[model samples]
Target chain A: MYLLLDQPTISQSSGNVVDGINLEDIKEFAKAFKLRRLGLGLTQTQVGQALSVTEGPAYSQSAICSALASQMLAAQLSSQQQNIFEKLDITPKSAQKIKPVLERWMKEAEERYASGQNHLTDFIGMEPSKKRKRRTSFTPQALELLNAHFERNTHPSGTEITGLAHQLGYEREVIRIWFCNKRQALKNTVRMMSKGMV
Target chain B: MYLLLDQPTISQSSGNVVDGINLEDIKEFAKAFKLRRLGLGLTQTQVGQALSVTEGPAYSQSAICSALASQMLAAQLSSQQQNIFEKLDITPKSAQKIKPVLERWMKEAEERYASGQNHLTDFIGMEPSKKRKRRTSFTPQALELLNAHFERNTHPSGTEITGLAHQLGYEREVIRIWFCNKRQALKNTVRMMSKGMV
Candidate 1:
């Protein structure tokens, strides 16, 4: 079901209301939620991590233990999760779906705070049991080669990327992402220069 | 010289001062410049466009007329020019290099404003004579095919991108950028989901 939601759509017409919920009300709620979250001295990351544990199905014990094994992955994953509020407002339907869960969580957190359970972890949950692959850093030589290829052709085939990866001694996935980032950088530069030119 | 400035450098050590100019002063100036720009009811784009005309060499009359030919390109280029302030303070040396130009331009603007020459164009120069390629919007079928390819292999070589472009009846460049944006979107989704998992 979640995977279905993840499928890309070119556009989602955001009407004034969705699922009998007013867009205006959701916008107001979003603003208020941000203020309330800040007032509690909690970050979006903390809320996201906490909500996963409390609202979702528990991962198996083995999965939880695996998450605990890599502190670096935990930190990386936590950084990635820090923008839940922004994500919620992407579409009216999504905002409507997430509102109730957030409202309930915020209320529980406030109640705990009032009752003197001030430690953030007390309400937010134990440390997140999530892991992520480490960031890839390319060598300068590899970057030069990649840039040379990009200058010639912005897109490379799966096989070509695999070949480059093998030649550069990096993961094929890393090489692929590098191309994507490189293209983005080129687009941005052109955009910036066009600004000056225009 | 400008090209040299654009060279990729892994790191630039920003100290408290550079070339007898204080970093603190530059930071304060950046803040003030933003405020002053706002006070003039000016956007960063307007300033960037204005600066290109006023501070740099005239981009040949032919180039300016070429820019005038395409209104769509002009609008696109204008949007890209926005965010000059953020770009200024990337490094202390860069900030110092640009500070004088911005300061002089602001002073001239203020003088013009005080004298009742308040029309933005009077100081900001004529509309930017810049052009950019039109944005590409992919069909649903194209996107579906692209996503399928991405799932199998995020990187597609030049030949594959050209083939897809021909198959879809779109420009090869557009198809390549589609792959790039798709990859970025996937990375962002993974990051967002990781936040939830953590």
Candidate 2:
């Protein structure tokens, strides 16, 4: 399902399209999402901050921008590329991922505004986020060991993960997630290298 | 920021409006998301199937539909409620959540199509999803006990949760998640009651 969208276009908006994806639809959504964000009187930075403190993992402004639009290669685009979807800097998949989070947040914010509670605190739930474990700051030495373990084998058994957790004074689940994220990171890195961008 | 958007409108589309959310934008995007999905020759059912087998939690057909449109009460709409934005049934927050997951899956599927690997197998990814954990089916006795505990205290300390896990022979995390989901369900139920639906 991984479509290598980094490459420039081959000009086939019709007939046996690559990925069977409708670029036109993706383009429209991206433009609309941006407009909606603006209409909410919220900036990308503000959305980014609000999302980070809510629930789930934090997303950066760059991530948000990528979901909405990517920087297309100048050669491929027209001199006056007004539409965000003209070149489709961002992929359809990334946009799909981000749209809902932004949508829901904006809706909630608007509701608060409508109710006459136009405060940022009211937008982000007043109750602090549930205590999902605090962000673990891995020391250099710990990272080295973890990296070495990962290099040896990405998929460590529960027992092995538990042993490592005991040794490093971290939770077993944390170590497990670390391995998962590390493998994902490695996979992304390898993919980048293959694309000759590394 | 929980914004109850079920009520009738306050009507302030211009000039420093509260509830600054643009339903028009959300409606357009929802329509666009559907078109893109159709262009890819994928059904909502197919997408739901594909999402279930993937990394994240499974999404239902209702979830998919709600992402695009929800069943709004007749009273909520005007006589000529042609536009989807007229008293949106689905909340923006929920739509935001589902968008990215769908977007990502569709892109992957389209990529598969472009590469001439236009099969469900190819679209769902080559390797099987990593086995994180299976869904636990709690016994009737366990459910009764758990419900009893929940009635007493909606919030259980980690130690208490661990104790329950050991007592019920279930994973601590599963028990914790159950509590979280239960609380959410309860909150949703309360909201529905407030809206005079139940």
Candidate 3:
């Protein structure tokens, strides 16, 4: 169980982060800490001990989940630690990386909770019934074969693609989707270049 | 093999990133992308396709490696990206997640080399040679069991250690080191907090 520490507000002051950090950045990290722990498959109690909170009770799953969703949608609801940034008004500059930032913040929050912090809550903005899309995971060997084939032919054709799939003993569609995702990822990276999106 | 986009000066004279991005961040991402690809088990050409770079004539294994190492380390070396207010000029704060970050960087560098980027040839002034450590990656469940056990009785004496190990079906030393690393992680996190080490 996660220990929710009652945070005392510092200043909600804004300043450029020293060493690439600021309160905004820290807030962003708080979101991430929670998310990463969740992603790491740790329950709140496990997270609490990992962080070392000896005083408080372990976090209930709902409380942890709510804190993640709520904080992402809005800031800390209560006055305790209200010094967090202007709640959840994610700026235009943030890209998809915004979600990862929130996840990181959750990781930090988990860390805080472990230190005997009081119960903090967050609500997921999405419907409880909603399900996230499962991302495609690639295997190292499969990727190598594809890379090798690509290096052999600067611009491969559909036949070539199918042939390689046959050679690799896989269906053509998987190769097709891989190409599609790769293309999209590149586009995003290049776009970041154009927009100077960090 | 990886495609070598014509060598883009990470930035022209003004040093503003080609996009609004800090060059280091993109470079960092490029490395991460390479790692993700490597983790996927893909070769340079495969990664090229994913990024939508044409494979074959322009792409080469060596180039891929160059991009991987250069992009990852450039940020670390960049005074601009390092930190705006690092009074002590120590490691970057982003450097906080050292193990995972460095591991990811290494994986990417391998991919870049396979793709034929020659940029790593002159990376002389960067980080110190890494000291190798032997630590096995633990399954999440195992880590949980260890963390939970520690919470109840932190410094278990000999029989307690053996008993806990016997109960959990773990080696006494594994439990021992889990506590060690757990303590270390907490100390570092707290140290980061006190030093404004975000």
Model 3: DockQ vs. true structure:
0.02
For every candidate, the chain B TM-score is 0.49, 0.41, 0.29
Give the per-residue lDDT digits (tens) of candidate 3, residues A47-101.
4433233223343444444433433322222223332222222321232233343
Residue-by-residue lDDT tens digits, candidate 3, B1-198: 222222242543345343254555445545555545444333343343323322233432222433333334544444565542231121233222232333443445556545655322221112122423223345466657665554443455778776655455444665677666544443333332232212
**Could you tell me how far off, in angstroms, the CA of residue B178 lies in candidate 1 after the best superposition?**
2.1
Q: What is the C-alpha lDDT of each candidate?
A: 0.52, 0.51, 0.42
In model 1, the Cα lDDT at residue A64 comes to: 19
Task: Please provide, for model 1 over B56-160, each residue's C-alpha lDDT reduced to its tens digit, 9 standing for 90 to 100.
Answer: 644443332232222222122222232322332223344355545556777778767767755556678765434578887777777778755653345565788
lDDT of 2 at A65: 40
lDDT of candidate 2 over A1-198, digit per residue (tens): 001121233444433112454444444444455555545544444455466556344343223543344421211234364343332233445445665666566666666655654344445422354655434557577788986676456678999998887566455677899988755543442322232211
Which whole-number lDDT from 0 to 100 does residue B23 have in model 1? 47
| Tens-place lDDT digits, model 2, residues B28-138 | 444555676677666676666666666444555654554344311211223233232222232333333443554566666666766765455656533443455777898
lDDT of 1 at A100: 66
lDDT digits (tens) for residues A1-198 of candidate 1: 122122232223344344575554544444455557656655444565566567763321111111111221222233355343232113345445665676777787876766654444456645453344334456577778986675455678999998886667555677899878655543443333444432
Q: Model 3: residues >4 Å from true position, as ranges?
A: A4-29, A32-150, A153-160, A173-198, B1-198
For candidate 3, the chain B TM-score comes to 0.29
